[model samples]
Target chain A: MGELRRYFDDIELGEEYESPGRTVTEADIVIFAGLSGDYNVLHTDAEIMKQSIFGERIAHGLLGLAIQAGLFTRATQAYATLAFVGLRWKFKGPIKIGDTIRLRAKVIGKKETPKPDRGLVTVQRSVLNQRGEVVQEGETDLMIERRPRP
Target chain B: MTGSYFEDVPLEHVEETPGLTITSAHVAIYLGLTRELAADGGAVPDVLPLCFTTGLGWRVPKPPLVVLAFMGLDWQVLRSVRVGDTIMSRSRVVTKRPMRDAGVVVEEREVVDQRGEVVQRGRFTYLVAKRTKETRA
Candidate 1:
């Protein structure tokens, strides 16, 4: 009953994290593609994907970003936040269905904004494959409400 | 792309559409590759964070499974998923409105587990480009 109490104070900038990785399936890719309407052949068709440099159907890169959202906001109770200032993404490798992945995040910086009611938080997010290779990366800027302002 | 404009979307729209199904392996692989960023060496592997993956699975065309943000999202937990389960996802146009810059395609997604039980549902929206004037059909 005590695993969920860490906060911004518990972390440091540039620190890297690694989570228990899991595998992906082709069905997963199609569902995501079908649901999102992203018909990118690289993620849907194995034969077509095989022709790509990656040689297999890869999971949607957004999976990494969604992982960050799922982890960060809940762990820190950050969702009560005001606004997400920005986000950036990087796809390092192809994530084939059935390929396991580890979700991770690191605090790159934190700052108190000029507004008395809010502050700024920045994080570096990433996803790695079972091979320990980093596949996806991202950066986030969030506005944290700290107090009431006139 | 559905090319839904940023005007208005209705619930019936998604209801008319079909949901999608995926696998636990894919969910896990996405997290495995993403774990490198979580600082805990990773994010939630069991329950909490998972809702997001389940949620993302339904949302479609997100930033990157590895590094993007929800942009704007809303997810409902109807049930939970397991390792071998097939995750089903469905979405609909919830909102559409014009943007001064790029047009938007707000959407909603619902997810179900292999047992046909709903795992999660979201009342969120997605965006798309009205990049150039699309020809009227």
Candidate 2:
């Protein structure tokens, strides 16, 4: 883990964090396909893909986002994480197998929930491929607990 | 199955998907692929991953060979979903816009638990190819 347990108070707006990168592989796609049950031809049917514009198979957009989430969790140990509130994301480009990707995340906004012990943190996440191009970008909100009363 | 073309999608009728019972095995497989460890020793993670819900939505019925590409997503997790929860999904076209050879189709989707409470909702936009002149005629 990159950071110790992060509480609501520990998060600072505008602060950024970069995550380690991972390469997408064929096996990853197959496993994700089974887990998600998304057998879209674009993701599964190689023969059909040959005639498509992309000219090859592409990873599912959600799979890329899910991997980004894993990278976030691995980069920070937020013991106070309450729940994943929401997200608005765009898939800027197709991520083919063998493309390496990482996350550039920053705390963009925050708000206090009605519950005194918890708050919402909004993060701007950019998923970048090996070539430094942003393949996906989004903002995700997470509900986190404040530090326990000392 | 032939995917829905831009002109084939019905914007009003919400399509429902078969219900699926979330299991520990599903959670484990997802965690393994993502290399994430459960925060606790429960069968499912404390908060179910949003991708799981999105996956359920993808099972909704659609026309064949018409979906060009997935464009974007906007989603919200309204409540926590735990292991053994039976969930179903419904989707309806929210918007559609035409382009030169393709069109954009946006669908509003909701995932509901056995209690019939919506646990997740989102909009999925896709670029769908229009029927060729031959097919349209």
Candidate that scores best on DockQ: 2
DockQ of 1: 0.05
Docking class of 1: incorrect
How well does model 1 score by local distance difference test? 0.51
Best by lDDT: 2
| B1-137 per-residue lDDT for model 1 (tens digits) | 23332332344453422333444454555454433222222222332323334444424443222211124443434443444555556656655565674444555666655566666555543333343365232
List candidate 1 segments past 4 Å from native: A1-17, A71-80, A147-150, B1-137
lDDT of 1 by residue, A80-122 (tens): 2444555555566667767776667777887877776666767
The residue pairs found clashing in candidate 2 are B2-B63, B2-B64, B3-B63, B3-B64, B3-B65, B4-B63, B4-B64
Per-candidate interface DockQ score: 0.05, 0.61
Give the total clashing residue pairs for model 1: 61
Q: Is the docking of candidate 2 incorrect, acceptable, medium or high quality?
A: medium
Residue-level lDDT tens digits of model 2 in A59-79:
988889888888887666554
Interface RMSD of each: 9.4, 2.4
